[model samples]
Target: MSDSQKPASDPRYPDIRHVAEARRLRSQGALIIDALGGIILCPLDTSRADLRILDSATADGHLLTLIRKQLAHPESAELIGTDIADYPPLDLPENITLEKQDILKPWPEKWEAHFDFVHQRTGLAVTGGMERAVETVRRFIELVKPGGWIQLVDGTLIDHKIAEDDKAWVKLFKVLSQCVTLVGLDTSLGVSTAEILKRAGEGLVRNIGEKQGVSPLGKGASSKELEELGYVELKGMHSGFVTMLKGMPEDKRPTALEQVEGLLPEVLREAQAGECEMRWYAAWGQKI
Candidate 1:
């Protein structure tokens, strides 16, 4: 269907709850190493006792937990997290406070270069425009004290081949990518982040670490777990795409959801089979 004619009630994108549930499954050993890596970058000192942290699109605060676990004084670092939706129904740590705001706009008047560190994940692709999103990141970096850190964790939806290829999986990827673009977002991180940072005048973009993995059902004990995790991660992607499509004319809604729904079972079956694998990318850099 043409972008202009799509409906407004297409399924909603997955929320923090869904994303958190996926993380929970992964924590339970659902072969989600890639998810884990994307959530928390390694080479982190965790011991840096005093840090001002800002988690953008902090859905359910899963990444917060991961960072807290890795840091030395989880209780001591100051944190401010924001999301476009109402803050997810997750408890904030004593050290962290939640704010509801749009990151694409100017930084809040109350927050003035107060952070020592800033972290954002997943929201880059949801923010509508790459240039605007990168500008937001630039603002985030501006909020941090010089010599502080700015870490970003995100993934692209582009699929890479493993041992086997399924037409269903391929079709699913294409539809989802289209759905994302329809909303003015890009699903591929490898395609944009560095350029975004550079365009924003971010200095010395160093790759702290990188990882890639597949989401399948039974490749190992971890495979089934990954499937459960996919439900969460993909739910967010699905919701975001649907929200964008829903903005279109009403008649085209069903066709879009049908395209999405039709692929879910096959994707689920692959997850269950544990034989297919998809690529997930991750990277982190410091603001010098």
Candidate 2:
């Protein structure tokens, strides 16, 4: 809600290079754009006299793939993507304008209650515990124009059943769970996203719907992509946790990192064998 509450040195916020790779591995390079519900792509009203869409915490604007393919584009559909930095001049379509804003801070007064759709990927936006995440959701609600929709997608929630039969997945997920928990956020955020949004938006958020299914990471098209995403998620977790281990024995830190690095091969092997299936949720609702 205030600038004083902003997170610092967030390793969860990956660089452009990391974002490029991660998005490529997700939703056929649009970062799960395909998973977005019809509320966005199929808006009921055709009167685009003043349509607006907000892509918060958009990294490199890759999620605008659909807009870029618009041959008969909506005359007033404005796709604005915001992030902390432009990061070496992203290549975005004309309809998708790039802006600089950190969602952890208060958004511009002009932006409040003024977007037909507000979309955010949790891995790119909110980090930290429930209180912080709730506030972030509140900000997202603030940006939505009345009768607009807000959709949120969180990373694959850690599932012990998926790891039970695979040692590599077990190891990697263990590290992920520990790191995410340390940051005061639930590992089940992916599965419980609807509740989070409902809690944060209470009176305003309505008609909640959630989509969640197991995506294979082995011997399937989606599985192959999941392999790539898993690698990045694991590496990201390692990077975040290593920083938090500052007071630990210097020798132990590197060793722990090394151990994490070693698990990569197992992730690859298990993924190749189709032993990993990630479950994530895409929860959305209208702001009434």
Question: What clash count goes with each model?
Answer: 12, 3
Model 1 over residues 1-288: C-alpha lDDT tens digits?
A: 432223322222332334344344334223345545444553445578876778877745555666676667878887777765542256657777777666767887566667666776666776666777677777877776655566665556653432235456555566566655654566665446556656664464444444554545334334454556555544444454554555557564424565655565665566456544455444455556
Off by over 4 Å in 1: 1-44, 159-166, 203-224, 231-256, 275-278
Looking at candidate 1, what is the lDDT of residue 169? 52
Every model: Cα RMSD to truth: 6.3, 5.7
Clashing pairs in 2: 216-223, 217-223, 218-274
What TM-score against the true fold does each predicted structure earn?
0.73, 0.75
After TM-score superposition, the amount by which residue 31's alpha carbon in candidate 2 deviates from its true location, in angstroms, is 7.3
**Highest TM-score among the candidates is held by which one?**
2
TM-score for predicted model 1 compared with the true structure: 0.73
